[model samples]
Target chain A: MDRNRRVSVEEVKHIAELAHIKLTEEEETLFTEQFNRILDYFSKISEVNTEGVPLTYHVLDLINVYREDEVQESLGEEEPLKNAPKREDRFFKAPRIV
Target chain B: MKTGGIEEKRALSKLYELTAIEISEKIRNQEISTEEYLYSILERIGQVEKKVHAFVTVVDEKALEKAREIDRKVRKGEKLGCLAGVAVAVKDNICTRNIRTTCSSRMLENFVPPYDATVIERLKAADAIILGKTNMDEFAMGTTTETSYFGTTHNPWDLRKVPGGSSGGSAAAVISEEATVALGSDTGGSIRCPASYCSNVGLKPTYGLVSRYGLISYANSLEQIGPLTRTVRDCALLLSVISGHDDRDSTSVNLAQKDYLSFLQDDIKKLKIGLPKEFFEEGVEEDAKGPVFEAADKFEDLGASCHEVSLPMMSYALAAYYIIAMSEASSNLARYDGLRYGYREENDEGDFDTVFSRNRRIGFGAEVRRRIILGTYALSAGYFEQYYMKALKIRTLIRRDFERVFKNVDVIIGPTMPVLPFDIGERIDDPLKLYMCDILTVPANLTGYPAISVPCGFRNGLPVGLQIIGKPFEEGTLLRVAYTFERNTDYHKYRPSL
Candidate 1:
């Protein structure tokens, strides 16, 4: 592996475009340097031996935190709709749904 | 709006050292009027919140009314609930009836829940005054408050730096005395990380110990609501009020809890505390290690035994945390269609593809959109095993590492973060670096163990936190150790002069 391999300015711009963050040209230059340094810090992790390890997704030993099957009164329809920024009667309004 | 500023700050200041339990005793004995305590803190919120930006909403009318009702009960010689008159802040992610629950995301910038969260209902029954909803990361996705559509929350200790986030605003509020305490949701160190940076105590209870029904999901399996406070005893008090079996959250544990304050008095005489070798490393700032070791030394002086333990899988904790968190996030956030709740933008330019893409492109922030896309790609049929499944396996190894250590030790101690709070814009440019910020606290989240970040000492004039990891449902032991440490050091009492 080429340890000195570096991503170019254009490549950083391409990633910024992909991420949809409207970055300035200067931001592209800054991020390219920062991203490389971050990858260097992160490369340290791959050196660890993770063989035969089971991936743990959640730590809580709880299998199920089920509540009794019962319905409670909703806070009423008007209360929620009242706070909507753009609502037309019972429903919230949006620009276009087509 | 004129809340007797000077008188209120002084009275509320007196109750700052008192736990919700102790405050209730004072309220019962008529040492302080309920209105006097409530308004005093509300006045302080008014005085400091403009600069701290700790609260997103302040329900002054509702809080004042609740105080008057409590006063009426007292005059009638009626009994009050355990947390009566204690002022608390809720993270904007937690639902509250008649209050906007934005989750700090523009997608739901104007969304309001139709009901109260289970914990909110309990707090109300106990007569706890709901000051307002505090700020958080947009959709609880980022580490810094910068990701919020509203704005970034500055660290109270040092305004230019971030309060480690997505719960940054809540932690900042408690540190600045904007509110006595606040509730924050943790998924992979959101609570503990920020609590450490802001010099407050933040607890991420074992995943199912607290209900997640009202908390907007970030990573469903990893999220837990916990308290962030200025002291360990207050954190214990907050936990006592929030922990219980909740039918609303399918995964909430029904474990019995004793009065957590009782644990503070218990002896630490023969308890074994583990210090993981992987935690103390070259990447960690040299200054942070001193306080961590100093805290360990204090524990030894308190008659507890400390040992070095190995958690080899911890090196991958941050990577695993991101993969799993993003994968779950991609799935969890899919519900926020332009149809159900929140903002909607029209795409008149093209066909179905343009329309769908445009909606998300405009609605979500750069970080939120990045995680969603990454998660969606990772969980795609072809990549699940390579990314998501493999991450889960690493997670299990991490948990097993903790279980193995816990077999011999009552608690595990370490630095909350590798470095202290960084400047606001420092890591935002590199997503990977931002994710790396949670390295020290992620293992506890992966394994479902309860961990807390307590104000232990200072470095370069800023506070440093000591993190303690406890076995499941052993919050009592965690509190006792933290309280004992706080008693030994004046770290918790050192409020920022700002």
Candidate 2:
């Protein structure tokens, strides 16, 4: 475990920003300490000699599976938009980005 | 000449005590109506739900309607499915059509899916009555069910202690006889952990063996929906109903299905069971270890051979598992941005990023936010190679380690959890310390091997689980071994006095 690798408040804020989450001042301070400890525990992976090992993204022995390009009856627009917190007609309403 | 009230209560308790298989037989033979069976379970739930807090929502009306339909079909002499008339509770993380599947989080508190999960469809096809949704850790994140927004599910054996989670409610439901069987998803020991703490049987099927089509993804690559039941035979029956190919889930294998119940022979003669030394070393409590070793001796007495094996790379499995799971969770949980389904902040009339951030901040709990933040950091540009990639490489090594060990031994056996059920709120604040409890169970999830947690013994009135890991898609072997141990021991027979 490397002490130099401890996460800082700035890093925690940046990570939260990237994760689309807003943290309060108290939460930011709390996460800074918790992240450092958890990351320090994760640092143990560096000890393993994985020099020639390939990264396993998935455990199954499957490749890209292609389904037939057939039009099928799926959920209607109303069904999906039913749970939207704010929906205008059939489309989900969101804050303007531009 | 006992009191009528006491006699009636005893009869009802006896009815609730019958195994799912026996109840199904009685239903099929017209000795008991499916409606009566369901009423008995619902009655018991009404009795203990306040103490246990096992269910997030109980679909009383819908369950009765379905039970009546099954009973009507039974009276007509029509064919019934394998699980006909059985009461099955599903973890809230798995989607249910027209039923609110809240994943124990406020984020999806009012969100109802328009579709059922593949396993739910299978259970419906088997005529299994869906009792209701069980509580869980919010987004299946915590080891104990305390993180649930609904409330913590108490361990049936001792209400003060936690039933291990994130499938805590499902395991508690079974142990308390609220439901005959349950479906729980295990990202890293969610099912087995609760099963251990509750003294029930849970199986995490080999990845891709069971379809994950409708399971709300906590970690897409690491989690698999599994069964939790009071008996190994019921576990196998539930597995048979749910296991198979689904084109909807691309990762699901198109393997031939077998009647898992047929593998329940009491004979493990000439079987090769490996006792991994890393699992039983220091950190494992003596109370938890004693029963597991005794179980190994029991296997040896049953004419099976037990050997001490080593999966040295297992020491790094916890690190690798959390890194991978949290990274995946950060990505999977990014969909709850207030625009689509889930909780939303209506008054946020700011920029898109502000709305998204605010929605998530208010929607997610502390643990979920922590994992999402850490995961984003792990995958960040400068840190990807150092954290995320390193964890994946270690995952490869862990997989290879299991592959190498499986060639010599048919199965690896060890304690499911390193400690007995801790008092609720003991480690809730210390997230890192809480993660340590999963050390022994995460290796199977990392390697995509099938594993099961069966009650082996008790410690100071709390239960200990023995975990058996088998080769990929070799759940038959795992169930066979579990069945043997369960038959030879009376550990699973001890029910909570609640």
Candidate 3:
């Protein structure tokens, strides 16, 4: 929330990790500079007093949209799994977690 | 009616220039076969596509085959759908079964969806031939089409200038007569900006009016698949085909289905139009303002009331839009890991984090990566309240501003874009300057209002669009107003001279 706080390179690296994006050293520096400028522009939002304004998540005022929980045909396992980089019998293969 | 005469050739050439409604009428009356119509459109594409670069993938053979199928049905005296045999260029973000639906990004270059989007299903049901997937900004993330990974789509009016984006290719295709009509997604003016630049009629329907089942998510809340065509009636016809209830998309509203083309009455009598004063202030180009104000005068001439109104919160709309869009994008794009559908690293030797990060780094373009990172920062632990939370609050205020104004005015009118199309690569490197182009257009997205951008007139040899925004789900009024304006002016009739 620091008004004039600049995004340090270390913070940029941390954020890239959180976003699952691997940045080269060059990208790190570029992002730091761009972030400072873009965030500085966004900081102007603090000037407005939104004291009692409620946050709007969706524009439509519809509440939870419910549907019948009946079974319907889906893209059988093979069609969707066809695009996976690595797949086992019928599932996507990923590296071991442990 | 000589077969090889010059007059016959000219008459046949004019067939490709007709609007979708006219084409449908001709087809119904047996005046033109679908095969003949497709041939003329394909000939026009051959003539102008090299200069425009509007399509990422042109399904020429498949389209011809589909046209032939429709022609056979016509010969059998069967009932035809509303848009039978109409050619439509779809923005690449919407998934098409077995077609390479890249969002003009390298990540999904080889990925093809197994199923069609709800909109595509509806289009197919209506017998509209899928022309091809059109070019777009990478992941629909940038203002100008310059950020497209497949290469920039040139504005048909001037090949050197950019077609405003992220739906630039759709706009350019309709302008250059490459397609009879096209579909484009608008999140913060993607459809309207390019429509303004390419001199076409583009509609961004109310948030949930059209199903988003097959659209590749950019900002889930702000984006909607809409139509871009050379005329307002064509826009409405396409909208009617693709809109309505779809349980597949949980957000799609089940509003009573209405024939949008029926709303295209050329009457704006007693229609109240509000002109936001801030949209005409300092940064807007004088040339762009001239056409908009003149269009408003024309509306008054047609017996409608035009008055200046103030929306003070509009100044903050641009910043709020970026924050909310980026935050949503960050979350939506997290599915692009090496393990799943999209681009994957070849080595495959690293652990999960390493593979995921490397895939994202290599797959996504620079702008997409930058927005994702900025969004991640905005939603991070210490900064969430400062950036994302405040942005949501401002969004509420902006929506309230529109609600309050619409109490007195049936619709609001302004310039779709503050300036004309710029030279390609003019503002690509400067991200802030590029973001400023959406200043006037984002308020509609923020509030999820239905808005249309229609070509008003030319400025400095380029086209200017006058935007008409209606109350939420009031697309009928918006289309009617735009249709009336088209009747009064010849701006929409001016071809790009490609």
Candidate 4:
């Protein structure tokens, strides 16, 4: 964690890319400033040492929940795929990978 | 729109203003037919929807049909569910089969759920009429309803002020008598903030107490679907209907359904109440701060001892809440690539990454995209240890803070919002300042505790919400306190004059 860390314009673009969100030039600059300000506010947390405190990803004490694998009723393509942008033969049509 | 004389107002009060209990009894006793009641509520929505903009979609025809169905059941002398014929306004993020669940985002503008959410199914079984889906912040991302893609929901109390987000529409609908009750999900104060702003009772149940199977995920770990109602008793009735075990949601608690209404008794003789000094220490507006202490004095009058307690970790809760919530949001929202469902890209000539990114960019609003990018950066290489993990560690500290205090106090009390509802566009631009408004409500979400907001008093003619945070899984106690408050005080009886 760099104390003087600031997100550059390219880094914001890269982050948007990683998140699969395309950003306009205006959003890039605006987000960079907001991010720097927010991150600086957030940096105050690093000062406190939580040496042995375990992180809580989920507040509830949940365990590996399992059920008997059995045949069950399922939603057919007609309803589940109703909102598909493009479909063919009860299947979602997607952009070409290559 | 048909109010002229005070006697006519008295006649119409039997329609939309009835609580779940009173309305259901009226239907059962033939004092009012369900169809007639539904028409009255629909007419109420018609009269107020133009001014408040609470609902994204109103199911007038379907609601009438359901109401008639309940009427037929009543005629048959069939057993009725507890909330039979009660009209419920649902937040658009919850799935309603054959109904659009937009989440107030262009991304899900036309998407409808293929099946009902578990809560929706339970509501149907309870014979509660689904009045409509209310508007919300895009993907439940912001503090004010102004981020809604449809439009902002105005506070019925003051049309100039905002109904708080992201459950703004739900709260507005409940307070305006547009609907008897509403279902809302809270991630970081979404339910309670709007309830505070609009002067309704809102509860965020313990994590996993209510099933979240049909809820559109914002922050999967932090959010819970809860009720916003005109009275605490109505809140309990709705909560009883929607909560319980559901195999559809693995996280749903494995306990038998408890009737929260049974917990409402007019007594809190020796309950210990902690007033976290930190909640009132900074940034709280004068009018808002005054009512909480006044409410504390009322609690003392009820024989509950009020003492100042410290939860210093509250200072870091808002920051940690945003980080964890945004991180989960970035991951949970990655599934909306537009091919399978949701807003579609017309020009489909690009490769997979290009199409996905393009759709997401065009689909999400500015705040949604901003949080997603920040989340992606926090979880990215070299920064995970710095931001996301540190936030989680602070989460433990905050939880410990609550645990340490709850051992001494039965419930923690504070103002639900640091200020009254601001003017609609007042703080939307300054995101940090807007986030500050949630400072009082997010600690419960951060700690997976059950909390309720009941109308305490008014601040400068606007209603104030006094928040009571109880121990996890003790929704019964939370209801007891709020119901007692509502019974003794006249605050909950105040209406917005919509």
Candidate 5:
């Protein structure tokens, strides 16, 4: 097991790619150190005796937050849109969606 | 009455009460000019904000323009809305049209929303001045404001101590008079914690009461936007303006609100207030507990009965909150791809991997990235059942614990935070130490109940927030009890000499 190691720059780059983030060289180096330390800390979780203990995620026991299915009126034209750099024909024009 | 010997009249003239209802009344009666009020607050911000660091971005030009428009309308004898020309500091999480809504994360540093958040639209419609975007824990993840990409907000009461977070900046702004009132989002005591630390009033409106359309989601199930002000009346007034159903947010409840401020005047006789025994147990700070008990004494003076109720699982709420909040946050923050919106870098080298690699790494902060990794691991395929599902079941138990207690009491009183405000760097090195600060306030979020943190008393001259937890959608009763406490005590009126 390669336990005595910091995450490689290559590995950090890979993780950053997977996470969809752009990293500067400084960030990659910084996160590599930080991530290694964090991963080391997370290793403590494995030490807990959970032979029968269930892994818990959400604290709220809510089964589902459901709302009654109903149709509602839209704001129609009464809605006044403000703080736009530009607007056109009751719609906010922006950079192409595609 | 004199603040710093600057003359009582000057201090009073400079003082901004953080409620739309009060501001509207004054604006309508021509008691104060909107321009006078707006610039006066801006000047106050300039005076005190250096140490407090309450705002991430101050929209001075826009805020002044909005105030001037309100002044113009008032001069023309136009009918005023509910909160004409009131200055409102928005939490960085909520999207503001053309305004950078960073959520205090590096991810959205340059991202400007193309449209106003629903609450922003509502606040603007009420003729409120958008003061600025206040700082927070990056993506509303931490209990202390230390997790912010912009750095921590100082407690106004004590410059060295922290204002509770991730709504710390908002609470500090209100306390230091940077803005009259500020909008804050609470997933797990973000609003209340800061409000408690800063000696201000903060409310976590019942889930679905306030529209969450434009709020940057930290934890979808737990998040609700509310106000942090200096008085309970301001919270009630803000609630009336912001709480309503919106088509954009399907989870919004269409329930009608009676005048919450009117409900504040109701008699407190025969009201059952629960004192959770588990909260006051050993490990609770002696200083914090003393003020909490004093607050309980005040509640008793208001003709309300206080009884100790047992919530055995309440002890594990902080641990459970972190697990659940991080898991949800990991999922919610996945949207900031840096491709569509928020700080996207130009990647001329064309691979999809390269595009994502350059974008997210530069965009997100260390805390956000850490949580994302933690959440990803928790919600991943194999660990889902062991971690996420089990937490959900325990969450049920936590909620049941509150439900059982609330059945015997109309409200529960406890310390909003378990300790006095720690200095800036006290818990920065230890993440677990930071997470422990939410011990007293996470239960309300876990139970999906409405809780308020109002100024109780001072502990060594620093502010203490007393939390009033009520049943779901029973914000009226919570406000009534809080208002009663505020009216009977001078705790809310205590201003920092700074």
Candidate 6:
């Protein structure tokens, strides 16, 4: 919860890589400062006595909602590909992994 | 269309001043031509849209064509839907088939949806014309429309100020008379905040009450699409048409959907109102705080019991809300890899990681990027428990805090925002300052309760929203309280002179 504890530039770059976002030099600096300040205030939650308090993953009381498995109309073959940036024989075309 | 008197003829010209119910009735009765009404709306958009950039896309041709179809239906002696050829502005985040469903992010600048959001289907079924897609904060992340990739939507009340966001465009559209009513997704005050700032009515329905079927995901667990309108009853009317069980959204509650309009009345008799003390604590200016108390007094005058309640965990609600929202956002937005849709670079070649990173960098705005990185950090191995899990645990306590207060009270009341609509560029740079504005509104979203913002009173001519949060699935009760308050006050009727 120490406000002073900061994510080093290396950590930020590492997080950006993990998040799949390439940051400009300005964004990197801005984010590094912004993230730490946000984390600092967000750390206020740590002071709460949440001992034995269960995590609320969802607000709905229902858990494991079950519905009968039934075949339904889908978006159809061409509908899904309509927005594809590139399509090759009904397949989404992408730069191949090297 | 008959306009016998000079007064009547004059009134007919400002059809934008009429409520959706009135407009629909006029269209149904042949007192007004739907096509003509659409033209006036388009003209109004052209007139004021320069000052209030509320829309990202205006489907004028499509809307006029739809209006003509409705006029023909009217001529055929067909029974009309409740909306009956009314124009409704949609928040861009809600997918409309063939209309670009940009989240006001460059990531999806040109991505036209292949399907209609469930609400859009409902609105269309009700014979409502799609006026256009309203602007919003990029991915609904910021508290102001300033983050909108297209441009900021200025407050209709004061062009120099912001229309509160991320549903600013929808609220502005309704207030500026550009649309009859608009739909906005409220994760954390996205609907109510704008309504508060714009002197309009906005409701964030109970979780699962409105189907989120085609609403582009932001924070799946937190947000719900609801209505923004000029009056509380219109909010209820819109709510009724859009709410029901939809199997398409697995989380949509299967239950008998009540007629929200049928439940509204000028009554709050015996209602127990709890004004959470924390909501009034810091950051709330007198302009924002005074009107809510005045509203509570009015409720008491009408036989409702009012008292102060404390939710000790309230201080941490904002932090917990941000953590959960950002975490969900980071996960939900991961699908925008651009292969299937959205913005992607074609000529610049690289492997998946290299390309995706580049696309996302160019795709997202600064605020969005800030959230993703912070979320990734929170969900990372070492800090996950300390931040996210702990935040979730705090969420439990926050819900319990509300539960404890709700046992003795029917609804919680407070200012929808901490301050009146501020200058356009005032706090956009300070993310924390903007987040603080939502401190009063986030508790409902955090707990999945239905909350409605009604114009209570204004400070220095600016509107203030009185937020009434009710029990889960009790939107009927929330709307009733707001309707009761609105009936007794003239605040909701205050219009900005454009």
Once superposed on the true structure, which residue ranges of model 3 sit more than 4 Å away at CA?
A: A1-5, B1-11
- State the DockQ of every prediction: 0.27, 0.86, 0.77, 0.83, 0.17, 0.78
Return the TM-score for chain B, candidate 3.
0.98
Off by over 4 Å in 1: A1-55, A60-98, B1-19, B346-356
**lDDT tens digits, residue span B361-424, model 4:** 9999989998898988889999899999999999999999999999999999998999888898
Per-residue lDDT of B323-364 in model 6, one digit per residue for the tens?
999999889988888788877887558788888888898889
lDDT of 3 by residue, A1-98 (tens): 54465788899999999999999999898888888989999989999999988999999878898988999888876898878878889889886555
Model 2 TM-score (2 dp): 0.98
- True C-alpha contacts between chains kept, each model in order: 0.29, 0.95, 0.81, 0.88, 0.17, 0.83
TM-score, one value per model = 0.88, 0.98, 0.97, 0.97, 0.86, 0.97
Question: Which candidate should be chosen as best, given DockQ against the real structure?
Answer: 2
Candidate 5: segments with Cα more than 4 A from true spot: A1-18, A21-98, B1-20, B346-350
DockQ of 1: 0.27
Question: Residue-wise lDDT of candidate 2 within B1-498, one digit each (tens)?
Answer: 122477665665666777789888998998777876777898899999999999999998999999999988987889999999899999999999999999999899999999999999999999999999999999999999999998899998999999999999999999999999999999999999999999999999999999999899989998999999999999999999999999999999999987999999999999998998999899899998999999999999999999988988988899989998999999999888878899898686789999889989988999999989888888899889989999999989888888888899999899999999999999999999999999998988888999999999998999999999999988999999999999999999999898
Per-candidate Cα lDDT values, in order, are 0.79, 0.92, 0.92, 0.90, 0.78, 0.89
TM-score of 3: 0.97
Pick out the ten consecutive residues of candidate 2 chain B with the lowest summed lDDT: B1-10
Per-residue lDDT of A1-98 in model 1, one digit per residue for the tens?
Answer: 33473445676555434333335566566656655654454344445556777555555555644446687776577775665545777886644445
How would you class the docking of model 3? medium
Task: Please estimate how well model 6 matches the true structure, expressed as its whole-model Cα lDDT.
Answer: 0.89
| Clashing residue pairs found in predicted model 6 | none
